[model samples]
Target: MAVVLAEILAGLGLLFFGLKTMSSHLQSATGRRVRALLRSATRSPFVGLVSGIAAGAATQSSNAVALICGNLVRGGVFTTRDAIPVVAGGNVGTAALVFVAAFDFRLVVFYLLALVGFGFHFKLDRRPAWKEWLWVALGLTLALLGLDFIKQGPRDLDVALISQALDAGLSPGMGFAIGMAAAALCQSSSTPTILVLALMQARLLGLEDAFFIVLGANLGSGLATLVSSGELEGTGRQLCYVHILVKAIGCAVLLAAWIAVALAGGDPEAALAAAGGSGGAQAAISMLFLALQLAGAVTVALARGLTERIAVRFSPPSMEDDASRPRYIHRRAAEEPATALDLSERESMRLIKLLPNLLPDLDRGGADFSTQERNAFWKGSTAIVQAVDHFLVDVIRAGATRESLDIALRQQARLETVRALVDTLHDFSGVVGEFETVPPLAFNLSESLRVIVLSLAEATDGGTGDDFDLLIGLTADRSEMLDRIRRALAASEAGGEADSRRLMHATSLFERAVWLVRRVAVALRPPPIEDRAQDGDPARQEAPEGVA
Candidate 1:
């Protein structure tokens, strides 16, 4: 009994390891391409469904498709409405795996494929590009091999004893519970479903028992997704909720139908015999699972509006889910410093992007900066800066490589610069808010300041050194104009000494704001390669004559 248990445990471990390895590598290799495809293909629901089917089949995991869709929605590439059909089609694509599993394809074929994959990986010049696919092939081979081992494990034991242990005291509810537990433990419905089919083939479990187990496995797959999506919020959370809800509803509907059939005196065993015994039973089970999934897909697609309403109601946004918080600096991504850095960079860029919106424009004179807008902007910008800082600290603690650390440091520098820019912009907005009371002479200064701000904003928007020299020239021209304004205010007596001082103070604030904006643009600009080799002296590489 102990030996049989050991063999079973080993087989399950291999299966799980293979699945994890395969899914991770597959995601790494194809995630960007899949995202791009989804973005381009999701012009309509039907196209999204086809894209999802292709992506899910290629990756061999519906969860991967869900996650990819979730990311697309989170990134604003797709709406929650668009993602629904893709997720549904992912279910259909996942069913393809079960369908393929029903065949008796020799394990040797997988092994040969893995070998060929490895050979290609080593022989190819693009090893980095092809290595993930090889790992995926190897993982599939190991998973198939693990299934074979699991099937052979109980052969040497007392088949009657094993069968009795599984079925003698097991009610349908108990079978469902067992299957759910197994799938959750494995974090995979396919593994447990295939195992149940193997048990059916060994004559240790009947088709009726397998039916409940398969239902439970489907529910368990959703549970796994729910657990994984715990950290996601807003649209990402909605995607996960949709996945779980659809799966649960489909499984429940099937379970109810099965109960109704049984109550109507339907013989499940007779049905299995007619389907062609054990092999037919496995295929039938796969078909039933596929049908339930397709039914869920059709139901959701037909009522997309209602489905979306339910999803929104269930996964409504929280205060933290608002734009004020760091949207892309996902804590879950901290384990991968490169990903964390990328997310942090995006969040920082978001904060910087808000600068133009937050800046008060006198040219649009009647536009009022409402209290609500100001408060929200202030709160959101503050929260994002703090969140990004905390996230960066976490990334550092996660022990990044030297290259990753350098990237993180650069991101941190950019974050600090953005913070500075925001602070300066806030002060400048306050100055502009008092523009109504300013003397007429300050209008020319105001116009000059506006041009400077616009120019800086454009430079920041470009986000490249390609225009740094141009910005530097503009800044120099503005600085000279700002000096003239200050000298005129100092020399004037028409507005009285107090008005002159106020005008000068406002002008000073604008000058400082322009300088900070220019600094941000310069900081964001990548240094030339020639200067990069200076080893920490890149700052010493001077801009053109106009730039300080």
Candidate 2:
């Protein structure tokens, strides 16, 4: 008994270790393929399902697969409908552990180690072909190692122990609950089932009892699916629910079959053992399970299609779902500083795209909106700017390589400059629209400010001259433009075409905006990253007025 228990525990450890090894190495090796697959999944439901299966199998963890699926769905790589089938496939694909664990276990550990070593060394090689081959070698090695480990450990367990444990006078309800608890504790249905099978092989329990436990195991597996479901919402959530439903139905069917066999005066254990032990029996059971999994996958696919149809019927036709936005970079990617840097850059670009949208309202004297709207806009802008700040700080503190840090510093300066300019614009808009007292000079400054902002925006977008050169040019042009607008407005007021006081006030507000815009641009440019690095103390004084 002690020997059997020890082997069982060892097998569990190896199973997890092998999976961990495979998932990490596979992700490093096949990250591109998985991302490509995710992108492709958006095009079709069948493709998504197949891709999910392949990805899940490679990762050896359904939870991770689901997370990626959810993110991809969020990222617009897959619609909620398309993502459903893929998530279903993920559930089934993750069951590979069950099949693998039914075999030898130790050989997998050695193979996985070899693959890891090869991957690490080969990654450093300059040859592209060598690198590609190395990744493939690593993936295959880990899979083979996992296969071997599963084969070795279970075969050595006492079969009677499995039989007896299964037969222990526990009610079907209690049995199901036990299975759920066991799976939850193990955090994997595959591991618990493998443990049960090992006990069966050790002669610890009869085959009839093993079958009931297997049914219980299926019920327990649904719990895992449910937990995974929480990661998704709307259609994705519904499809996950379907996964649980299918498994529950399968468990019921199997349990009923066992009862019928037992009542028919037949030895349920002998019958079950006959089915499981014989090649034909094993094949039949495999086919049954496979069919159940396939049916579940197919059902979700259909449900997803129906869901889309219903949604389109009820709601106006739209080309895209707004919820499709990438969330949660895998924390593990932080281990690779370069990858982390790229992720940070992607996030910055997302913010950049959102920033320009804030300009229209702020440009107009629409700042006197309803209190809620005004506050919302203010809070939103501040939140965005603060987010960028936090992201930059994190990049610096994360021990990012020098190249990564350089990239981050550039983003920081650009975003900060944008924020300052936006603040000035907002303030000017509010002031001009609120006051009736017009200052001619202020009106001139407002027009100049607008032109300067527009020019700066263009130059920034074009990535043209250095920030300094562009700002200086814009400032000179803006001064001239401000003078002309102010003179024209003052003349209009003098000619009695407009209210002199209101015009004067508008002009005054505009001038203030123009001055702030110039300061903000200068603040943004600072010194070039390369030059700053060369300085003994990298932090330098802010760029002076018109220094460019």
Candidate 3:
């Protein structure tokens, strides 16, 4: 018992390690491509179904595919609806694992591992692009090898004792319960299903018991996944719902079918006997597992509309979900640096546009956002900034004209300012909201901050020449104004020591916000004709309106 337990532990350790290695590398390699694939899936359910199958087969695990899909959703590349078919197809793809295990390719894993190891030894997998796939291959082979070790480890145990204790007289309900428990604990159906396959092959567990256990494993995996995903919300949670529905639907359908067939006098055991003993039994179980997954995938695919509606009902879209995604920047634009840089700027425009909502108390248009909504907007805006940052990096790497390079370089620098401005404004809003009695000095500073952010948004979004001049004027150095506000706050009879501290802190953030906004405007402000005429000039001349 001890030896068997040790083997199981070893196998599990290797299996999980291989799983992580394979998934992280594969996800890294395929992240953007998967997003593109899901976008295409929006055209039709059939295409979505195909995308899921490819993602699963390429990654070779449903859990990995779910994670890939989840990250894409989090990044705002695609919504959950676009991902459902692909996720369902991934489940169908994992059925291939059952087929592979049925063939008992235990020896093949070592040869594949050897091939990969030698490839590593020869440095054949060292190329920048090829490296991730090499790791993927290694991880995949090791996972299989670990599974093999798990299967073969039980040979030393007393077969009779194991059989009697486990499945010899196991009732269908008990078998199903055991399978559910094991799969729930493992958080995947693959291991439990494969273990049943090993049991059948060893002639220690009967076909009926194995069938129930396999079905139960599917059901258990769904429950475990749903539980684990308790923290995910909005579109992110939709993927979790799709995952559960796939397993739950498949298990329910198959279990019902089995009951109906058994009641109709379909002697499954006799059929296995006629087909030739344990080999046939193993084949039968594998096919059933495939059938179960297929049933789920098909149902989810055909009911795509219904599935989406159900998911949305359970987890409605949040403001952050919409906010986090990039509107204009995408991978395709990378080949055109000018166009990509333009898109990056447009994406950045979204950040400044959201600044008004930060302090509803100060926005000129009179905004009102719940604490939750404000936080969501800020989170989403941050995601967009990060997305634009990544897009700009790709633009720089794709090569460009000197002019485009200048724009890209300036944009990169501006991003730092935008990030700082966003943080400053977020902090400024928190501190400004702390007042029990709003002071005129603090209120004026807060309102001015909102106007600068609003004007900056308009300036970037095709604002006229006059608009640019106004933004540059608005955000110009406020060191003098901040000094005045600081003095006023220090002398005023504020609420208390805490109020005085908050007021002073808000002044500092206000100063930073103005400076950061000015930096953004200066970047947006074109170089003066005096500098442009010098053509050979380094263009280091100060922007008009002292925005330098």
Q: RMSD in angstroms, candidate 2?
A: 15.3
Give me the runs in candidate 2 sitting further than 4 Å from their true place. 1-3, 103-166, 225-246, 249-277, 280-288, 306-548
Better of 1 and 2 by TM-score: 1
Q: What lDDT score is found at residue 453 in candidate 2?
A: 62
Candidate 1 lDDT, 97-137, residue by residue in tens: 67766777665756666685667766752588777887787
TM-score of structure candidate 1: 0.62
Q: Give the Cα error of residue 470 in candidate 1, in Å.
A: 18
* Minimal lDDT window, size 10, model 3: 269-278
lDDT, candidate 3, at 170: 88
* Ranking of candidates on TM-score, top first: 3, 1, 2
User: What ranking of all candidate models by lDDT puts the best one first?
Assistant: 3, 1, 2
lDDT (CA) per prediction: 0.71, 0.55, 0.77
Candidate 2 global TM-score: 0.53
**By lDDT, who's the top model here?**
3
RMSD of each: 14.9, 15.3, 5.9
Regions of model 3 farther than 4 Å from truth = 41-43, 74-76, 122-126, 167-169, 269-278, 325-350, 359-367, 386-420, 427-451, 454-512, 526-548
